[model samples]
Target: MMVKQERAARTRQALIRAAAEVFTEEGFALASLATISRRAGVSRGALHFHFDNKKVLADAVERQAADVVARMTGEAEAAGDALDALVAATHALMSRLASDIVVRAGFELCGGPTRNTGAALRWQWQVWVEGTLDRAEREGLLAEGVSSARVAPAIVAATVGFEVLGARDPEWLSEERVARFWELMLPRLVAVAR
Candidate 1:
């Protein structure tokens, strides 16, 4: 029974990975279960057994990707202070989006022109940033002139832009590019140590 359960788990993961790749390349409306199953090297029956349809498969992919993002940020929280966590999360997110197909697909599906699943991932990211910045403000970590309310949206927009542009050119999500962003913004955002 354990062997059968492990096999099923592997098959389910395979389907989710294949579905994420298809969704990323073809958009939600254009992606088909047949294509995903073929990409996974699984039978249609096997695919159906794992997921009821493309939407379900996409949800699975998004769920996995969301978990990754949550864990990444959660880990970031342990790095240091709120400002440090924000920095760590931004770098980690860029790296993840570059390397993880499911993460890239989740961000894509959030605002894909072909789908109406809502901007769940983007909202999730924005909320985290906003909260982190709020913490920074309360902790006296932010520059005197920096307002969390003012900077949070800009930070969210820039990161989301990176995610969108990185879909076409990987350089947009590169460590150097992300570092450059922080290099320019950090000096203004971080409070000087007294």
Candidate 2:
């Protein structure tokens, strides 16, 4: 029974990986289970045994990717300072999204048929950012008038904007460019220390 469970877990992972590749290359609308199964070298029955349909497969991928982001963000939250943690988390997310094809596909899937999954992920990130801001405010790290709700979306928008731009032109999105973006934007959102 243990062996059977292990095999099932491996098969599920294989299907997710295969689907990620196809989704990255062909996108959600174009990606098919047959292509994913072929890529994974799994039979249709095996693929179906794990996921019931294409949407289900996409949801699984989104969930896995979200888990990764959550872990990174949680680590950032554990860091000493709220503002620093937010910056670190954003940087980590952008760097991962920039380099990972599967993550990119997951981002794309958020707007396609699996948009609900995307929205859920986005909401989670936004909530994290807002929570960080609230902590910063409590700690007096932020200016007195700053609202966590306002700044959270702004930061998220900026980070996601950079990700979208990077996806379009990786060559133009150097580390320097990203650093410059943060430099220019962070001050506007963060409270200035007197």
Worst 10 residues of 1 by lDDT: 110-119
Model 2 TM-score (2 dp): 0.87
Candidate 1 per-residue lDDT, tens place, 39-127, comes to 99999999999999877888888888999999999999999999899999999999999999999999888787666777889999999
Task: Assess candidate 1 and give its lDDT.
Answer: 0.92
lDDT, candidates in the order shown = 0.92, 0.78
Judged by lDDT against the true structure, how good is candidate 2?
0.78
TM-score of each: 0.97, 0.87
Candidate 1 to truth, TM: 0.97
Model 2 ranges off by over 4 Å: 113-118, 171-174, 189-194
Candidate 2 residue-wise lDDT at 181: 71
**Cα RMSD for candidates in order:** 0.9, 2.4
Q: Can you tell me which runs of candidate 1 are displaced by over 4 Å?
A: none
